[model samples]
Target: METHKSLSPDPNPAAEDDDHPAARRIHRLALHLNPPQGLHSHGDLRMLACAAKGKQLDVSTQELTEYMRGKHRDVQERVYEYFNSRPDLQTPIEISKDEHRELCMRQLLGLVREAGIRPFRYVAEDPFKYFAIAEAVGSVDMSLGIKMGVQYSLWGGSVINLGTKKHRDKYFEGIDNLEYPGCFAMTELHHGSNVQGLQTTATFDPLTDEFVIDTPNDGAIKWWIGNAAVHGKFATVFAKLLLPTHDIKGIADMGVHAFIVPIRDLKTHKTLPGIEINDCGHKVGLNGVDNGALRFRSVRIPRDNLLNRFGDVSRDGKYTSSLPSINKRFAATLGELVGGRVGLGYSSVGVLKIAVTIAIRYSLLRQQFGPPKQPEVSILDYQSHQHKLMPMLASTYAFHFATLHLVEKYSEMKKSHDEQLVGDVHALSAGLKAYVTSFTAKSLSICREACGGHGYAAVNRFGSLRNDHDIFQTFEGDNTVLLQQVAGDLLKQYQQKFQGGTFAVTWNYLRESMNAYLSQPNPVTSRWESEDHLRDPKFQLDAFRYRTSRLLQSAAMRLRKHSKTLGSFGAWNRCLNHLLTLAESHIESVILEKFIEAIKRYILVSALEGGSFAIHKLTEYLSFQVRNIARELVDAFDLPDHVTRAPIGMQSTVEAYSQYTQYAGF
Candidate 1:
């Protein structure tokens, strides 16, 4: 079993200099915040911190990049190099939406032709390579990245996963070569998150041997479909499948199924008859992709167009499925498309790396106020500055490691198709997608503020990165809904503990999580504030496990209790806030465990030192360790300056300031 399903405090012995103004202020703030009290210090902690800053960072940038990029490094680097070589591929500042969209389309084609990105072919041979191509493109232009995903990962994915051999033979190459751009028409105007509630209909017409795809109401119009406004000729339309009952007035609702519906003429590039397309228009970011709304008025496609991997309707309009129920078929179908969530998780971590890379690099070069009469210190030197960027930097590294692990697990699950493995991967991907994207989205803003006015400049790229990434938390599954899914899955695992059910590899950690919960609040363990204790990876892991188990137990009981009065659905709604906390606690534990497992010896010992689950707060002594190795740690992320495109991210301080000044027209 995979060991996933996948820390304390300190003392004040540093002898607060009662007369020192800074120390006095610290005490006052500490009191106001009502901080836990234990006055002690780590003896020789300063010496250890100094040692950590040694002559050179022990880790190699190439080695770290190799680990983070995993097995897809070749494809990643190839795509990266292709874009790096294309001067025009670099997006311009404040271009019109049409121009930006045109450029993105151009880049998408050029990347396919020049970069040799065979997205569908890669998905067949190695999905990681496909994701690598997407991730690499995203690092350069997110709009283009999303455009590629909409075509390859969603529309093509639905065909590949839901359709069988005939579908693959006919459409795979076309989809791969861009001969038939496609959209995943899943989200409706009135139903974004609730797939089961969608009102679009695909009624089987036995007489004509066709399925009449219809938007029953305005609510059923497909909205926010990438590639629908322009370029798309086909779509994987998800709608309720209905079968005629002996030509009577009644039809049987067979739940939702995916059908290949052509929305435009391949030869003319014109909207097909009975299909109306409306451009979604420009918004906060990612205007490069042509997002549009789609409404189908009794559009007809052949019965064979239904992707029949899970269910099929015979010529006579009799529906049959191997799956026992609509819910099971829906779950299996959606499970196959978990690749999107995994890809989003991978791409989100990349965004965080760039955001932190730019922010940290700028922080190291830009100077601000310092001791009187002394040279102004680089903002990176101030404790407050380190607090802003260092922990984010650490968590970036941690999330990167976790995302890498997630990629491996997803690959394993896809190839094996083991029910247990699929469940683990599904829940893990959902949790990480929600957690990591949300983190990266917020981090982008924090990074912008950390850079002050410069980050606001379009040249710095923070604002665009911030805006483009905001939608990540909503798509691939809304963050809140995804977290609830995680929490729901976790609650099942909680119940299984009593059923004597063995946990899956992903949730294997659950087998032992209860031990920590049972023994936690060990008065001594809770108050252990020494540096060594906090730094010990075991204590950190144990503390995280304990917190998660504690929350899981509490949340499960809360739901059970609420159900007594509010009933199941109402009970869930009542306990949602508590459940989300449980889900976050579980995911963070998985990430920290993976981070420690991946690179414990690295200077990021403090990466999660002050994490919420920590039993005891870390001391000021640990800040030096973070400061000493923060540069080396970010370097290990190995993002080149060219990819960042921020004038303030140069290695040389003088060059950084000079470039920023030039960008500012000074």
Candidate 2:
């Protein structure tokens, strides 16, 4: 062996140039290792047997679970346990769409009737009650999740939010008890995102004291309506309310309004006269949902069937509404349905939790190629796998909190009916629904890829989970349209900041951000990379806020500049991409702020080696933190075995191999 004294002196080329003592110490470590004259004999280098107990952290997974649960634990746990215990839910998805649909329906009816959990009643009393149930069901099966949403959130929620006391008195009990299986008819073939342009007509009739619901063209047919193909007996149909007039224009278009149109007979379950329904057929995912298309051929609904809370038709065939404009009425109607987006966002976050949990747990159990003469190590020990999963885990935690906040805002808005709060929650829900669902859709595919070939197996759930979640991006509202709505709201706030309009609590950040935007970041901030600085919550928040404000201001300027020549809509069209980027940036800022508010400090950092800077000490500290806290943090997600359902994601290697062998039919 080479003697220490005969070894080369420090290869510290930067030793002379470096000023910091730590920098010099790191440089000297460069010469600390030396190779032997020849490879060591097997006897000399062979591993020694010893008891090396794994280190444990002081973190409590239970406490973290409680934190994640917030005030909704009991409700969620009830729902989670219900599905987990049911052997019916544990079965594979090898069944037909009809079987899947019937199974989903069975699960839904059991939840409501057998479990005696009326999520509909909780819609007004406590929104989290319903939200918790929705999220829990979503984690187990996205198809069942969508079925529940269609039944409870969309159909039941529309009645509660948009209908008057009389309308409620007539339908609420039936909707609550599953006596009325209903679907929402909002998205038409031609106009999904633009509810204002929906072509279906609900013409008032003075003689009959009814409204004639008619699809003017094939494009006006209600498409992708859940529960309509096999189960739904009624629909909360959205159509243009046309009232007969004595003037030049024979009728007045009352924009879009909701009416309870009976799509099927409660007894026979037959499609009603003049109402046509066809199955949307097989989908790329969410096949368990019986999605269908509906076309109305002058379907007659009683005048009382109109959900008259927002806009009403009287016996005299006159259109009456408290909202002053057609636009305000439409806004009010959709505002009530914001709960759909809220529930969707919350459920999407839960789906992501399942994916991240499965991916991380499997990564821990999986062993792959190793260095020469060493045993295979857990995939999670590899930096590539960590990079794939840790950020996703972090974001899931953030989204969990942020989506809960949206629920809170929505609940408060519904109760108070505060106009400003309503606007804030609408925009917030829309942006979050778009951003979170898009992320989950993309992250599912990534999680699939991360697990390698095993992820390809349907039993492992990544393929099915990803496919089911893919539709979340376009349903409720298309992501592109939703983001534009958010950007429009942001610009409205920006203008309000100048027009002397008082900022609501939510938009107040915009005013402060605008002020901060006038000044540039200091040189230190511009070049900030210190470990402490990077981890500081204040620094992270300020950076996000500044980025959002800068985007908002710049996007506004671009629109203004283009408007000089192109006109308003043309200018908006020209700046569409920039506006979308601004919308997403704003949403990211909000999510980051919420996450920072809820979390305590702990993170890892990476750096590229370069000019004589001292980072080794910092790097070592971060490495130790990862080994200490990373595993426990992931464990805190605490997905039940049924939820994960992956062979390699189980607790022990035996369990994994057994499950894999069983799955392989060996």
Candidate 3:
């Protein structure tokens, strides 16, 4: 193991002089930002405490660290034992055949009773309310956790609101009580991302007053469905609604609808007569989740099974929908998926928060090289160390703030039923989820390295956190796929402006963009001047607004021009590059702006208290830290280290040595 010597920059006489305008300005900004107080705050940190508590096991941080250091077999055994021993702490309710389903439901309900949190009430609380309940059920694994969380969050509240009184009466209570574990099966093996191309069909059967659900081929089977393999008895399956006539074929033939299909027997845990289930097998991470594939062979469900928020059918085979446009209807259904993306982003934040805490705490305690004549200094004192870790710390804070803002926006949009706002939320959520998860993957690894060899040790939590977060980038929707959506939306906005002939708007955007590009080279260094610029509030606000607008406009132009030279598929392929760039820029702008706002509002408020004065100092330090690491973090997004450095970025021996020095203080 090798350790780098910590270098303390020589104090500038000018910086020490309080009377100096630069020093005063820096101090003022710090006071204004109101940084974090001592290590603890507001009755233990919400992020860490929540995550630690979610594991259900009362193991201390040290115990967790030791567990990680032990053999893989030992770790797995402990993990399973911890979960199985406390069925009361976490429930594993599965809905299958009559007997098995009833037994599991009773077991789950008993656990719920022990927790003293009602089924309905749990649905309305944090883990459940926010779609993180899967995290509570430790053995469920990440895949199942995410799937369950998404299903519960979507159906727990909105489903009840959207369904008819009869539909609600039949399933809502059972679902709330975990008496009927349900699967939200939408993604097909052949067309996971391309939902419009789904081949599963639900034809109206007037004779039985039921819809005949059929998966025409192997591709049509529901894949990667959590709980579907073993736990789910019923599923909210999405299929195309094939109307009787071709007159409405273009629209109606392509009509995608949701149905509540029974997939398994309640007692025997057997697949229904026509249904088949296969466990998805092992994955890179999220093993607790029982991801599975399901094939429906002419599965039958009553007409009333349709979750007709936007469209419905009568027993007479008559079709009706308030939304005339099939696109709009599709949007409404797909829009529900946005919550999953948003929740994943927040979860990433939580995970990153833990990583940052571990890295930061480890850095503070672990000492490294110093002058040969002196004691070793904390590695955190090195600029290179700070460069590696602080930006991630800043990013963690940035993501935290961004997620809270997004959730607030989503909550309001849901309350007002604002379509425009909903679109914005969808776009933003997609972009942020892609951006945050991608960065989290990189950032977690960096934190691991920053900790040196200790980071590789399972006990530090970095390895598991990294492994758990690995799936986030690809699941829900792949980052690249989601970014394409963001890019597509931006391109549309660009097309609108171009067609509208908003020359002034276009020129203004270009000019601001140029200014931002130029400003990056010669960032304002005068603390006093920059402080003045930031304090104007309007300037800071406009900076982000302008940056986002310009990035969108520029990317749109590039994509449009690139598309013009190619066919539709080619155009889409070419546009992806530009789209990713723009989406990243937009997400970065949001994060920075949100961080600034949180600092101003929340941090500043605490500064007025005498006991809270240290917070102001911490805020000042973090602000400077952010400024110092901004370029590196941005570089991380643009040119990931993995791409730039071959074996260096791959899991390498360097990371091992780095971790060794960090923890063992070699």
Candidate 4:
């Protein structure tokens, strides 16, 4: 951390020293500085000595991670310890798929029993705390994370959101107490993002006061359903609710509704009558989830089985819904699943953090070619290595704040049933889920390559991370489909502006575009020309805003022109790539803007509370010394040694080297 002489000539090297208060603070944390030798320039050796000692920014790292953890640190630590203490809950060593599934279920049931009626239980009261549990599980083994999410976040959460008091009374206690297991049967063999297109049907029978559910064809079968292979006793099945023949008008009028259908027998763990369930044999990863498929011939359920939150069936076979139209009702019903998207976004960022943490720490310990007969330099000292991993490190930090903001916004939206709020949250969550997952996918790939041969090892964790997280880009919602959803929302906001309307945060780009287009003597683009412009929040914000506005404005124009000639669907398909770009740019702008806001807020609060100088200096490094903030930002992810589980990412360089040498028999 101590400033040293430069290897390359500088007119005023002290200027670099003057700008970095973080280096000064981190310098004090360094116990000693020692340089390994052979014919290196005195100045170069001095710099190497500093670099060797420089990774220790103990206070800054802890403060930032503490800030990230916020009020949930105590609960997070307790949960981490609970999982750590239970070896059975941990991933096994090279087990077969059957063994993996069985062990995973046993571990899941243990967690359910342990977390009975608590925040980590079925339908958790605190969304952040619930996500924290997912994050911690994902850090060590994502297969376990997916299994846990299926049980609590997706299946149990559906009952909490879509079910009424009676439904809750019948299911919630059992779900919380592990008396029954479940799956969310939403995705069909042919229909994933297009939930309305699912061919599963649930027809009402007035005489029997029941609903007959059937999967009409192969395409309608529920597919890739977690917990369906072995454990689930019930499924929150989504299907088109049909009225009696006399009451039917057309297909569009009938709505998709959720029903609590029995899938497996409780005592024997067997499939119920008319239900055909099969295990999806092997996957790229996440084998612990027991992914499976299901088809129903003629399953019957009591009328009260319908999750009657948004739509319901009358005793006389009439169809009624609180939502006015099918589309609105679809939005309302699907809105219940937004929490899963939000949690996925947060969990994706955590995955990237884990990947980069392992890569960066390995770079610091793994040595490579240097001056002949001299000690080899750490790989991290190379510019090529830095270029590959540093920006991703910064992005990891940016995504951290962005996802947290999304979580907070989601929490606020949950309190109100306003249609506008629901739509807004849906659009935002969709955008973030797509952006963060894609980012993590690419980041893990880069991190894997960055670590060279070692990264390919299962022990290193990147291989599993890459394969398991690859599904994230497609499931929950397809990334491309979700991006298109965001673009459609943006177009809606664009049209709303003419009607004297605006949305919470997205509308800014529209307003900014209009003002920029109409301004006298257009604003200069040279505002970013200065050497320090990258460090200026205003310059960064303006650049992001302008790029987002230009792309969106152009996208809207293209859609309009093409639609007039090719028709709406044809034009949309033709311009799909542009629309995707528009959505991506807008999301990137949002993340950078949110990052600036978070840093500003932390700085303001720290100043007011008279917080630690180290934390204050960390903020200064984020802004003023932005060029050198890579290591600090990565450390801010606050991944504990236990969570990393990589020998190279242990507590200290010494600890990592100690374990590595022993393992290598050096």
C-alpha RMSD by candidate, in order: 7.1, 8.0, 13.3, 9.4
How far out, in Å, is residue 457 in model 4? Answer: 2.0
The local distance difference test score of model 1 is 0.81
Report the lDDT tens digits of candidate 2 across residue range 212-305. 9999999999999999999999999998999999999989988889999999988998899999999899999998999999999989989999
Q: What lDDT tens digits, residue by residue, belong to model 3 across residues 439-462?
A: 889988988898787667654556
For candidate 1, write residues 72-160 as lDDT tens digits.
77777777788789889778877888998889888888888777777778764677788788888898889988999998989998999
Q: What is the lDDT of candidate 2?
A: 0.78
* Better model by lDDT: candidate 1 vs candidate 3: 1
Off by over 4 Å in 3: 1-111, 118-151, 154-158, 246-254, 495-547, 567-569, 604-666
User: How many pairs of residues collide in each model?
Assistant: 12, 0, 21, 0
In model 4, the runs with Cα more than 4 Å from the true position are 1-59, 115-124, 247-253, 371-374, 509-514, 517-524, 604-632, 657-666
TM-score of each: 0.90, 0.88, 0.70, 0.85
Best lDDT goes to which candidate?
1
Highest TM-score, which number? 1
Sorted on TM-score, highest at the top, how do the candidates line up?
Answer: 1, 2, 4, 3
lDDT of 1 at 367: 82
TM-score, prediction 3: 0.70
